[model samples]
Target chain A: NAGVIQTPRHKVTGKGQEATLWCEPISGHSAVFWYRQTIVQGLEFLTYFRNQAPIDDSGMPKERFSAQMPNQSHSTLKIQSTQPQDSAVYLCASTISAEQFFGPGTRLTVL
Target chain B: AQSVTQPDARVTVSEGASLQLRCKYSYSGTPYLFWYVQYQRQGLQLLLKYYSGDPVVQGVNGFEAEFSKSDSSFHLRKASVHWSDSAVYFCAASRTGGYKVVFGSGTRLLVSP
Candidate 1:
């Protein structure tokens, strides 16, 4: 099981540009989660999906951050008009039950 | 609100020596505790989890954690440390059947030869 797969291990975008991170979860896993990691904030929950539907997104920034799970296998996090503060490692995790298996994460850099 | 605290920002240990990392949690309900490790440049990986029954739970790679409800603590330990064990350890907690998993500020472990 490839665990979870995240695209573009690294990404660089100018301020006000758009950045979209991709994640492909393990097969048959019904739950997917997204988190942002930084030196100051540690791991911050962004959003989550259960069975291809968004369950909770209380941690999302609400203005520019959005997430979607179009199918059981994949999900995406899109940031519109990215700012410098958006730079961080975006991590994706998938779980069949409670134990979450994480992907290598995408490092997003907004300059 | 739920929260977790990892008091130590960094810990250094000699190779083959025993190791321990401290964690404290705050929650009113029955807690679901977990310990996860992050290798450099990698995402976090689960080490162990404690839900009920025995307070002492074993994990992969010779890691174990003991949960103390009285103290609200779940600390990770290893009998013998290896260089590969150098990484950041994170303590997390959640309400039973809840989707929100709160994480603590990680403790960075460094194993020296």
Candidate 2:
């Protein structure tokens, strides 16, 4: 298994630009999660979906951050009018049970 | 709320020396604990996990962790360190049967030769 796959290992966006990150979970996995990691804040939970349905998004920033899991295999996180503070490593993980397997992650840099 | 604390931000040890990374957790009931290792610029990899059965669990690269209910800690240990073991270690916890996971800031290990 490829575990989980995240597109655009690195991305650079100017302030006020929009960015979208993608994730492909492992086959048959029912849960997908998104997290953001920064040097100052560490890792913060962004959102999650179970069986292609959003279960929790309490950690999302609300205004510019949005996530979608339209199908079982993939999920997307979009940041509209991205700001410099949004620069961080965006991690995607998939899980069948309690243990979660993570992908390489997308490093988003907003300048 | 469930939380985890990795007190040591960084630790240095010789290649052949024994090593221990401390982790303390705060949870009301039995918690599912995990230790994950992250290589530079890479995703986090599960080192070991403790759910119920055994207090001591083994993981990849000869790593292991012991769960202590009384002390509310799950400390990772290695018999002999290797330079390859140099990485950031994270301790995480979640409510039993819950999906939300809380992670510690992480402890960086530097194994010197």
TM-score of chain B of each: 0.98, 0.98
The DockQ-derived docking category for candidate 1 is medium
For model 2, how does the per-residue alpha-carbon lDDT over A7-110 read when each residue is reduced to its tens digit?
A: 99999999999999999999998999999999899889999999999999999998999999989989999999999999999999998877999999999999
Per-residue CA lDDT of candidate 2, range B69-103, in tens? 99999999999999999999999998899877889
Q: What is the TM-score of each candidate against the true structure?
A: 0.96, 0.98
Top lDDT hit: 2
Candidate 1 matches the true fold with a TM-score of 0.96
Kindly list the per-residue Cα lDDT of model 1 for residues B62-84, writing each as its tens digit.
Answer: 99999998899999999999999
Q: Check candidate 1 and list the clashing pairs.
A: none
Candidate 1, residues A8-101, lDDT tens digits: the string is: 8999999999999999999999999999999999899999999999999988998999999999979999999999999999999998777788
> Which parts of model 2 are misplaced by more than 4 Å?
none
The local distance difference test score of each candidate is 0.94, 0.95
In model 1, the Cα lDDT at residue B79 comes to: 100
| Candidate that would win on TM-score | 2
Per-prediction DockQ comes to 0.68, 0.75
Candidate 2, after superposition: displacement of residue B41 in Å? 0.6
